[model samples]
Target: MVTALIVLYFISAITNSKKIVILSGVVFSFLLYPETFFIICAISLLVKILSTYVIIKDLYIALTVLVLILLKNTFFSTASGYQLVGVSFALFQVCYYIKDNISCGDLISKLSFFPQLYCGPIVKPSSFDRLKKINIKSLALYHLIFAIGLFFKIYVAYVTHKIFLEDNSLLNSVFWLAYMYSDYLSWSLMGIGIAGLAGFKMPMSFRAPFFCRNVSQFYSRWNITVFKWCNDFFKVSGSKKYRKYKAYINIIVSVSVLSLWHGLTFNFLSFGIFNITYFLIQNKIKKYRKILLISQILFYFLVGYTFNGIIPNYIFPTISYKYGILFIVSLVTLFLFDFFFYRKVKKIISISPPLVIAVSLIFVTISFFVRHIDGQFYYAQF
Candidate 1:
């Protein structure tokens, strides 16, 4: 698939055949997964019809309902596995394309872009408009970005597998949540990295989420492109009488929408609700920010357990003292890395390419030793 896309990219670059490139690319994606393609086409057609026939404001509301139905069925597993996997992102892209009335060439390129085909940072059509230009300049930098992201993903997979193998306990749960966050971070980075290599300016999907001191900040930093899309598409502007509560209402509505975008299962639904409740509580007691932050971390740990359906026997299992200490140290270290070095890590790699390569190779080697048959990313299925 990668090879085919590379050939297509170069062909387009050399000949500048925009329509043919986009059409052929779309055809290739359809051929690769006909089932998913058909589903995407259905939703795309629905969105297109509504957008063309209805008023802009009404279309937004109707489109939201249409998408909600599709999500509830597919994401909640009411649809078959073949119908569900890979539909979430494709649905979002197609809707964006139809609403924006994007050019044929750009629409095709945005949807069929292989780097984010399976999962995405959920780029809006407007966002991809500026990325229409393609070039092969500075290819080495792209490779480095891809390598670093892939290394992080593989390493997280390795550690996650190891965590599951250990005894189930609060310590393991903490590590598990850490792994889950890292897994998501890695996935976003990988998408950005690969898209960059292809000369497509993928949107920023993550920032210093770990460093965020509040729930609102956390959501804004995490899965950044998704939030950006939500802000645009799901902007909840209440009437004058309800203006003071607009922020809270927007927070809940937006997060609920984004959470459903994650998946329509109860687990994801609860995750959104939990955050909403916490956000409200924090607003009422602004002085307890530190306590709220600590609580937020624990809430995430509970989410991991709830999402995975693997409850520990006790809140604090009677595990070895050494292992318990190890878990705390590991969790703190992971958080610290992201908090302090989130921005610097990328800069370090750009400045010291050889060192980055060496470290990536080492991480890959370690991954081989610790590897287990990990499943696709939690979000990738969507």
Candidate 2:
């Protein structure tokens, strides 16, 4: 499949960019691995056929591809197959978007490749392309930084998983949460490294996302690139005419797309609904000024635990009415609380050298101890 794509890319690059060659390349790849490539080709073909018949925009095509991929994975594939399809679709989407020049979708599709494909600090294409033009020295330095980030993701998260994930004790939950945090941080750092290596300017996604005072702020900082993309391409931007309502719509669409992108599993949908509800409530609180600081902690714990539980169960039964109900309930509760309360601001502490060393040592020690038990890094699969 990779070889076919490379050949096709070379042909397309040198030739007059005929659609036939492009389509043929895709077909060749599909034929090489029917189980995986077929679906990818079918979706791309659908987009191409649809684009010819209907004047549907590129963004819609991109969305369609994502939706179809999710559905295919959710309904058809085994666990490994599902990941393979999901990652393949993601990669294909990026490549197609880059070649087609389909407005913001094109740029975003390219930007979504590295960091976004993995743990996702999804970026916009324009910004990404700009970075790609940077000098070689900067790129090398960025790769080094990314390597360090990869070490933590592989080591620290692995250790935490071994210590807690396999044991299934109460402490396991705490360790799991800690592991998740580390996972997010490690991935984000890796993203920064990639962006730097690619020479793309760092968008405002990672500057203090962890220390955000509120859920909304946290999301804004955590994956500013995705947030920006959704706003630009998904047409969910804020406006005075319907700023509040628009914010809610953006939250829903963005979260839903995120869920679907994870592959069309019930757990992914649940996670999406969970986050949407959380964000909706967070937005409502902005108007009411009613923040529940403690609830923030509770919300994260509840959602995380529920998601963890649902994922294993979801693998066996991709669709479950009970899971759906639970998902809706979780979402509803998040909005209800968000509408009714205010949360206290937590103080940020300065990172002393000793504290940093301690944290690093703990992470390294834990990672080394439990490296064997860790599954493939989620992004690495992509």
Candidate 3:
């Protein structure tokens, strides 16, 4: 990965041709994801054809994208594992391309940009518009960002995942929540960092979700980009009638699509039901605000972690002092680290270059020594 980044960086510097840079992106994407890339190209071609002759372009494109999502979820995972790499994100981008009425060239670039495409911030057509390539000045900062992501996944999420493998636990539910957030956030931040190095400022995916008051708020903070995409795609501004019921329809549509986007399983469908049901319950009660607040926190975690089977009788078993301390650190790292550093990213990195360098090196060293997991990113499968 490091070698590829360096080569791409130098190649970008050496080439005066935009075509060369885009060609490299194509190769990088196809190399990691041959099967998915083929599908993306096919979709791009379809979008081009759709743009040419379709009279009702927007409606047809929307229907077509939803069908593409359904087909992708049904067929690809069964046929081949590698084909699933970035199908969800690429399909969504295809949706945006058609809606935004961009060229096939733009759609191809968005789909084949491996960093964001792999595990995405799900960028739009203007994501790379008017942007210059190569920002040597921000290279250190991007490196630190990537290192933080590595630490989040390879070290923090890895350590927290031990809670699952073993029975020992101070808080099974808590650590499971930590594990999910860290694992996903790590990929997100790494995507941001690499995308930055590749010269595009990506939107954030996680933003200190612990402060959220409800499941809706939690997800808005947790996967802000996808949440935003859901909202954007479903928005209705047609007539006053469409606008009047927009919020309710948006919530239902976003929640349902977000759930099933992970794949249409009993668990995911149930997750959507659970979310909407909980929303109704929250609306019914206006008092005991503290209790509802706490309940909302528990509700988010329970549905997220325990939806695979019947809910167990959780007793919150205790763990050894060693694991207990690690658990606490994982929570703090996943929840609070962004709150302190991310909002003020430029200021934090600018405070002391040496400190930033030290932190990046520390994470890199720890990643080298950490026992590696043998699987793709937990979110990538969906």
Span of 10 residues, lowest total lDDT, candidate 1: 133-142
Please give the distance, in angstroms, between residue 189's alpha carbon in candidate 2 and its true position after superposition: 3.5
lDDT of 3 by residue, 152-174 (tens): 77678877777755643334556
Pick by lDDT: 1 or 3, better one: 3
Alpha-carbon error at 129 in model 3, in Å? 2.6
lDDT of 2 by residue, 155-255 (tens): 55555545444444333334455566556556666545545533454343444443455566665655566556556567744568777587577767767
**Error in Å for residue 48 of model 1:** 4.3
The reply for model 3, stretches above 4 Å from the true place, is: 1-25, 57-60, 78-83, 99-106, 130-138, 165-173, 237-246, 286-288, 318-321, 354-374
Winner on lDDT between 2 and 3 is 3
Q: TM-score for all predictions?
A: 0.74, 0.57, 0.83
Q: lDDT of model 1 at residue 328?
A: 58
The alpha-carbon lDDT assigned to residue 105 of candidate 1 equals 43
Write down the RMSD of candidate 1 (Cα, Å): 5.2
lDDT of each: 0.59, 0.48, 0.67
> In lDDT terms, which candidate is top?
3
RMSD of each: 5.2, 12.0, 3.9
Q: How close is candidate 2 to the true structure, as a TM-score?
A: 0.57
Find the 10 residues in a row with the least total lDDT in model 3.
Answer: 1-10
